[model samples]
Target: MASKIDPILEYDFCVAFLSNKWHTPPSNLKDFVVTSIQQTKSNATNMVSIISNFLKNKSFDPYVKDCLRTCFDLYSDSVSALDNAVVAFKNKDFDTASTKVSVSLDSPVACQGLFNDKKGENKSPLTKENRAYFQFSVIPFVFIQMCRIHN
Candidate 1:
């Protein structure tokens, strides 16, 4: 129930999102879903970034803020890795990129209670870099939906 957006309903929504964005004539629902799922996974981080941009670039909505808060804690470890990469890059240590990616994957930030006591600080469900991760989350669902349709 955490992700209140119902997968059942969102499958249809995803199809719509796809039809609007892709102009190619897919062979069938299977192809369309497969392509769209791949693209969504590939661009997931981009979508997260876009959503984060939407949050920070504009006033925060209460509903959006709540939703973001729920998910942001889950992303902390990933954010720290991004921070680490920046430090390594600024120090001209290119060799550590692999390590940085490793840390980000394993040491994600704890987003629980992140906004509990903070006041006057802008809360993002995702930071600029974290937004890029959103795409990663969307692709699998679409892929599964495609399978369902094909089957």
Candidate 2:
């Protein structure tokens, strides 16, 4: 029930993340890996939709507009990377899957970085979304790493 049976994925955040998302607990590493990939893909897809909505808002200033546009691009790429990762996972290519997942993880950080002004006064409107995406992205990378190690 703790969702920490795998020593490689014993982190508290990972366990809690999986526990919240999974209705039936994962029985083994493959279950964990498959679920993690699916969930991360779903998260990325949702993020794309959210960013698209933000882009449609016409009241945002030019600076915020620029940041949102870039963030939208990053999240879009993240979705593609996660999609490729799903195929790689199905092929049992842990290396390719991990690489793609790792690429997906960078999107959140890159998106967050777009808000850092020179004076450090700007804040990302997507802060919460970026945080969730980063966490969702990490779970699959960790599971894929475990798969690589065991295989």
Candidate 3:
């Protein structure tokens, strides 16, 4: 007999972000991939909303405001990429899905880079959010890799 597999174990990096119910017994690979992508898209959408709210805040300096605007654009691109990823997955195009997910993953890094000066003295207010989004974005990519391995 085959040994039992754990879906949660396959997504170790996502454990902190995943809910208690997501830790239950193993699910099929397709279900896991779908869930991972959908959850990531949802998280990215929330990030966009958070950044949008930050852009509306008038207390920040011009430099900070410019950084936030760039970050906002980056996150918007991420949301669009993830949306395309979802459609690719639905179309059973794993390669396209993987490519789209990879594209979505770069937003946080690019956003964070905008705040670093020559001396690296500047810090981003969205540090925590960017880190969280990066982690969240990794889930679907990992799941897609798993699917590739299984196939």
After TM-score superposition, the amount by which residue 36's alpha carbon in candidate 1 deviates from its true location, in angstroms, is: 1.4
List the lowest-lDDT window of 10 residues for candidate 3.
Answer: 1-10
Q: Which one is best on lDDT?
A: 2
lDDT for residue 116 in candidate 3, whole number 0-100:
83
Q: What lDDT does each candidate get? A: 0.44, 0.81, 0.76
Name the better of 2 and 3 by lDDT. 2
Off by over 4 Å in 3: 1-13, 22-26
Model 2 is weakest, by summed lDDT over 10 consecutive residues, at 1-10
List TM-scores for all candidates, in order.
0.35, 0.85, 0.82
For model 1, what is the C-alpha lDDT against the true structure? Answer: 0.44
lDDT of 2 by residue, 72-131 (tens): 888788778888888898899988998998888899889999998889975678999888
The deviation in Å at residue 16 for candidate 2 is 2.4
lDDT of 3 by residue, 1-151 (tens): 0111323233444555455466443378777777777777887888888888888989877777899899888877877888888888878888999999887688888888898866876668899888778777777777777677677
Model 1 weakest 10-residue run by lDDT:
104-113
Alpha carbon deviation, residue 5, candidate 3 (Å): 16
Tell me each candidate's RMSD, in Å, in order: 11.8, 3.4, 4.9
